[model samples]
Target: MINKMQILSLTALGNLDAYIRYANSWPMLSAEEEKLLAERLYYNGDLDAAKTLILSHLRFVIHISRNYSGYGLPQADLIQEGNIGLMKSIRRFNPEVGVRLVSFAVHWIKSEIHEYVLRNWRIVKVATTKSQRKLFFNLRKTKQRLGWFNENELRIVAQELGVCSEDVREMECRMSAQDISFNPFPDDESSDRKLTTVMTHLRDNTSDFANGVEEDNWEMHATNKLTNALRILDKRSRHIIRARWLNENNKITLQEIANGYGISAERVRQLEKNAMKKLRTAIEA
Candidate 1:
């Protein structure tokens, strides 16, 4: 019993030597046991039955999560997301679907993990349209190697993936592209890579360049002063200032801020007073 209990413990998996041993120790449910548990939860809303179903299939979640390892996301976070999908599947699952829970849960598990990967896999989103998103996941599997696909290969991938060749090429370009710093340092020698960074040289082509420069300079000075002023204030006061003044959308009210921090509105007002005074003084200087 002690050996079995030790085998089930996930702690052993943290060590490379014992990782396979722990994975091998995971429990598998027989066909009868799986059906019984699913039925118990489906009929009685039995929480224990749900727990057993989830625990017994955790290895499946791990397996599905590993398939997405190419996305460069943390393995633990992928597993966590898959667990959420598994729970959602368990909640909505009907035993009458004529498939085992594992079969039904695979879609949900992969769906959740896929969403997580798509969201965090790149600094800027790679895909917005449905077809682009689908290609984003499947295109890598179609390719044979690390290098870019030729025109012929792109056509073949597009056909297999049911997208236009242009789409495969576009997504391929996106995947090949790497995230760059938005504000690259002035000392960087590579101008091409530096230009890839956003907003550092962003200019409104329609706007006057000279006045734009003047306005931009003023804004930068004002922002720096405001930031310095905010630093002098405490954490709560800084948050109150940003929530009240800095935030353009969904600006918070004194009462709302007070409610959040468990203080009276009048106390919040006093803090706002001191913060604004400091800002005005700093900005004037």
Candidate 2:
């Protein structure tokens, strides 16, 4: 029988091929051998027995993680999460249940990998609600080809998943959108990659010139409107609004402003409300 240290060393350093070979080489234990090991771990709290159970199932986790590689997560990371699941399953395994450890561990392994994929696949999560999660996994299976969903297809998916049609449309939009790079590099023009080089395109003379003119005009218009609005307000009202709303860390409670000005809090609140209403009417006019 292999020792615990030897088994862990093998799992840590072993390649996928080597681990598969090791799993295949180990003869399936007799029912008595399995029962003794499980009892030792569960009843006697034997670490060695637990290690043996986990080592034997590492290859099973690897096999399960491979099925989820289509989601673009690293295979090694997926396998690591699956191994956590396998350990949990081993910790809870019952020899009296009459089923092999592999059968019980499959659920645990896949559950861990599924969570990892959903979390790391996008910046904003693709699935929030339970119905959306079900649709996210099953929508690929329902679609025959890679095109946008038509109204008929949308209705079918919504009905099958027991969600509204608009929910289906929202989820589909989230799923179809790809993440865009903010400041891409110049040498990334490979045929295999989708992101464009931001520096190369943004440095174009025509685009820069046009954007500069548009930005200057907008700034001038905004400055004129602000100046006009300030002229319409009395000095104290203008000062209150500016300090409260225009400062960098701008928002203060009415009580805070009241304390600062040595006035009643209710009076401060009334002033603030009147100031906001006046600003709105001024902006509209």
Candidate 3:
């Protein structure tokens, strides 16, 4: 009996508990009534029958969404995703198979929610393989007391989940490791006050000094090679190469060089190519 407008109003104004109660209150259909609706929607392609089926199931999506609230995702978004899954199930549902719509929709609803959790939980996904993904969820339930799992417990969980003990340990480590802010500043620090942030930790004085010395040596070696390569070029070719690549600003075009030397643009390009080849050969030697 609920219209689209009424459903929209209820969704907008009602709290989570109110929605739960409203959905639960929808009368459970008798076998005869369900069969009739399923036949109409499935065989006859009756959209009105489909709409009724979906509205009746909206409450079920809300119920499943409640279970996932512990994941730190917004409840509204989870409900929306679950609703999408419910719709998909409705479209693919086979009423001739004799299963109730609620039973069929459960898998679809949970699949959509699981995908959302994996994608949003961390920037880098913690679970890649099938066993790791299973452990990622199951291991949370297996924990008896917080802290870390003991060796025996780890082995037991590995046996139960049919994964290696090492995988369980790795997943546990990943789960326990919280994301740290890249540039965390002290809470009490004022806007004008300059406090050392995480960036400060990136610099180790000894490593930095060594890196600087190595970089300087690399630049000096590169400069020597470049200077030696330039020496191998004829004057005009060297000038063309420098103008095309080495100049900081106001680089001359091939046409400008050609005009200056009273030569064609193609001739200038050929000279530049020859110069580059000679430089490369000298550098390699």
Better of 2 and 3 by TM-score: 3
Measured with C-alpha atoms, the lDDT of residue 193 in candidate 2 is 62
Ranked by TM-score from best down, the candidates are: 3, 1, 2
- Give the best candidate by lDDT: 3
Q: Count the backbone clashes (under 3 Å) in each candidate.
A: 0, 0, 0
Residue 181: error of model 1 in Å? 1.7
Q: Write the per-residue lDDT of candidate 2 for residues 67-181, one digit (tens) a residue.
A: 7777877776787778777777878988888888889989898877778878999987999776677778777556545357789878878788788989878878888898777
Q: What tens digits encode model 1's per-residue C-alpha lDDT throughout 1-285?
A: 012222234432465335434444658998788888888888988888887777677778878888888877777677768877888888888887778889999999988887888889988999877777788888877664535787777777778888798888888889889988866656567555533446756877897979989999999988788788788788998999999988999898899999999999999999999888987887787
lDDT score at residue 28, model 2, on the 0-100 scale: 64
Cα lDDT, all candidates:
0.78, 0.76, 0.81
* Residue 88 in candidate 2, Cα distance off native in Å: 1.2
Please give the range of 10 consecutive residues that has the lowest summed lDDT in model 1. Answer: 1-10
Model 3, span 68-138: residue lDDT tens? 78778878668767877777787788889989999999999988887888888887788877667778878
For model 3, which pairs clash? none
Task: Give candidate 3's error at residue 76 in angstroms.
Answer: 3.5
Q: Report each candidate's C-alpha RMSD, comma-separated, in the order given.
A: 14.0, 9.8, 10.3
